[model samples]
Target chain A: MATRGDSAGMNGGGGVLLLLRKDWSIFTLRHRIFVLTVFLMAALQAVVVDEAYFLLGVALAAALAVYVPVIEWYQGTDPMLHSLPVKRGTVVAARHVVTILGMATAGIVWNTTGRILRPILGGGGSDPAFWMTLEGGLTYSLAVAILALLFFPLYFRFGMGRGIAAFAVMTLVLLAVGYGTAQLAAGPAAPGAVGLITPSSVIGSRVDTLLASVGPAATVTVTLAGMAGAFGISIGLSRRWFATREF
Target chain B: MDAVLELRNVCKTYEGFDLRDVSFALPHGYIMGLIGPNGAGKTTLIKMILNLVRPDSGDIRVFGLDAAEQGASVRARIGFVHEQPTFYEGLPAHRVATTVGPFYPAWDEAEFTALAREFGLPLRRKLKTYSHGMRTRFSLAMALAHGAELLLLDEPSSGLDPVFRRDILGRLSAIIAGGNTSVLFSSHLTSDLDRVADYITFLRDGRLEFTLTKDEVLERYALVKGDMSLLTAENRRLFAGIVTGEFGFVALTTNVEQARTALEGQAIVVDRATLEDVVYFTGRTGEGGLRLNGNTR
Candidate 1:
């Protein structure tokens, strides 16, 4: 029944960009009211509390990444997406793109706002030394990326509630691993180490020598490349799992 | 004839229900009513065409391209209204349209605007607030606004009132009258099919009974009524199905001409069958020679 010579009907004009924009639009839809309320709470926490300001923003960013794919799903539009011209792979790709961009945006916006507003609201610059550290930014990015990278495959595999449940279990495992890694990074907490993390700056020269040999730019490149590799693997798994799933 | 869509030996099996080698084609610029009772796999067939549900073994060609492999291209040319139409519910009707419009290359804002006005859709009203009929109208408007080659609708008119149902039927007739679009409308309501369908595809218990021109169905099939004395052994074989009541006996014959010639001068009357008669009779007859599949002659 391969009539019409096989190539007759492939004029697919829409791409992942179309789906990406649609996902972004959901934030402004019904969920925006709730999202704004949460943001105010996070901001108040940042201004009033001495700690958890920047982490609150990163946590919210990760929360959004988990929330977007499930938004239309709850609206009963998930099956509707399969009817659209976009490929399944394309849909998964746009979601991954949204997750990555969403994390970056939420993280940077929080960092910038915290820097400007924390001093104004408190009338003091009790900036923790770690907040002054770019290393803290690296840690924030890792947290954001790790949460998203881990959640998507589970989300694509198990749907929202189950996916989050699976993510919660994995989060516990990751927290344990992160605690172990933090212990290894700690030499001794440096002066004004922000009470959040044991200062990696005080770690002796063996780590510095390794970075020196690798070169700072090369070290940065390897970290980013590692993140990219993790994203690639997660995308592949999501695509494979979603392909056979019928609505 | 260049078919806009075709399915050949399409078989999908699930626990407790299956589409038993169903196959048919919609030639360019005609409406095919996929008529079936509940659980008859009409919706399943429509979903298979959309590639939302993959068939176990079959080939689906749309505009001559393999539907499973070239789904994006094939789906791009199709405008679908699901059994339960879904859109971004939180937004106003207009924004929902805007959000989906980009996916369709031929989407016309002006055409959508006109359709919204014609359907009395309050474009600024949030879609969640609209009634089911309004949502169906919006789905239809969206389906038509895109220059789709094929429209696959599943029970699209069930939610509308009789007045709007007639209005929507007229619109479908007009849409296909342009001679570029074909529709495969799946609905259990045969009266709607009788109104506008050029062809009728009957399904029962996940089996395709027949796909024939509406004219052929009306002309060939007939209803026969007579006294119980007319129920001779030879004459009983003439009827595809028979029902006995207190007053008399009524029967359905697939070939009214044969039944007419066979029963001449007897106390029996044979009249052309309505689409409803055909479905009810054949369904009563159960699974036998009713599977005409699609007429070749």
Candidate 2:
């Protein structure tokens, strides 16, 4: 073999895009049924119950985000990919890009399905205009992002098995804290407010007051921006962590 | 640039094993067989060369470029075939090729298709469905399809039948016929290496026992057989992995000429040593296994 310096095959810089295409080819189309089932469940729940059925959508999207990485992990081929012409950073980039794309696709599916059903279900646009179909999709995404944003970095850092265990622990800790704070906030209110106190009611009342003060658009904008920033940071962290990792 | 691949003082330490101070060079347009027993650091050394594992401290250069610093570019000119099908098992053979083909800028789809057809691979079947021999064939086809200048194969012929093994070895010989591609083949089957390899690097217990040309190994190493009564203290020092049975004694000597001189006119037999004998004796004795008395080291 002559030195590869003069070789025609050493196209530099496009490894990331090449890796993305390969990963997408293997990962996306194979799970068509799962993606369909998520949307189907979201649609059924929305038509049967209420707009708050987005909670189910959020749960579905989060399940997908968590589960997508596991398939590739189970195949145990990522290390072999490292031996290919692609850079390690390119592998990490492709994974993060695929994950984010899956989330965006889920968001689109959630929004599209809700728009189709809202008229039939008679939502009647009761909330502010900003809380329309797209915002609801964004809310669902942000909720999933809360869990997924924590997951990817863990996956890159500790690998799939240990990372999932760590992610579960972190999720449990966050839920316990959220439950405690909700309990404290839902205690009996002062001076004859005359309302049944519940954790969702307390959080909902706080969100209402905040929306009234800042307007729904502003609140959505800030929340989406925060999630975007966190997602960006998570991407950077995953890339760095995966670069030095060994199979 | 004369050597297609080179390693200098490479070292990697795991929980229970360490590949220490491994250094060798593979000249261009030739085949180098990496032969060692199990856990002999054969796979670990190959992984280090491929940059799949990090070395504690060392330099690995491929095609005269640092394997780590110019890793992507270096790898673009190289093709690797793992011992197992660590591929997307759910995807069909054709899809797996499509998934892997584009990374090589010179990847030839027609070449891959031809190889797949030649190997009798069913394109639509998932890799999970393929047998071990089929997967090995698939891996070789993938490795050969892209006009790779260097091929690093880890046990590529492990589970193959005798006919396919000969066919694969013939293909390897044909590829190197052009004097543009080289191969570093790691295998437990020494008979295969004796058939095609121009150079042999024997590693045992994470340390290299010797890296010699085929002629050099054949010329300098020998297998000796004599009566058990001839097992003198001085004669025993020159033998490694000596076997004594009711029939008599059989041992490996790294210095064929010295053994010939020391026991001239005696009732003993000195015969040419095969690659298998070298690996077997050296591996039987583990590291520092050679009792060459500095003649063949």
Winner by DockQ: 2
Summarize candidate 2's per-residue lDDT along B165-224 as a digit string, tens digits.
999999999999988999999999999999999999998889988888888998888888
Which portions of model 1 show Cα errors greater than 4 Å?
A1-14, A43-55, A116-132, A165-216, B227-244, B257-266, B285-297
Interface RMSD of each: 7.9, 5.0
What does candidate 2's lDDT look like per residue over A36-102, in tens digits? 8766865765544443555555655665565546767888886677788777666666666666676
Q: How big is the positional error of residue B42 in model 1, measured in Å on the Cα after superposition?
A: 1.1
| Clashing pairs for predicted structure model 1, backbone only | none
Weakest ten-residue segment in model 2 chain A by summed lDDT: A1-10
TM-score of 1: 0.83
- Which docking band does candidate 2 fall into? acceptable
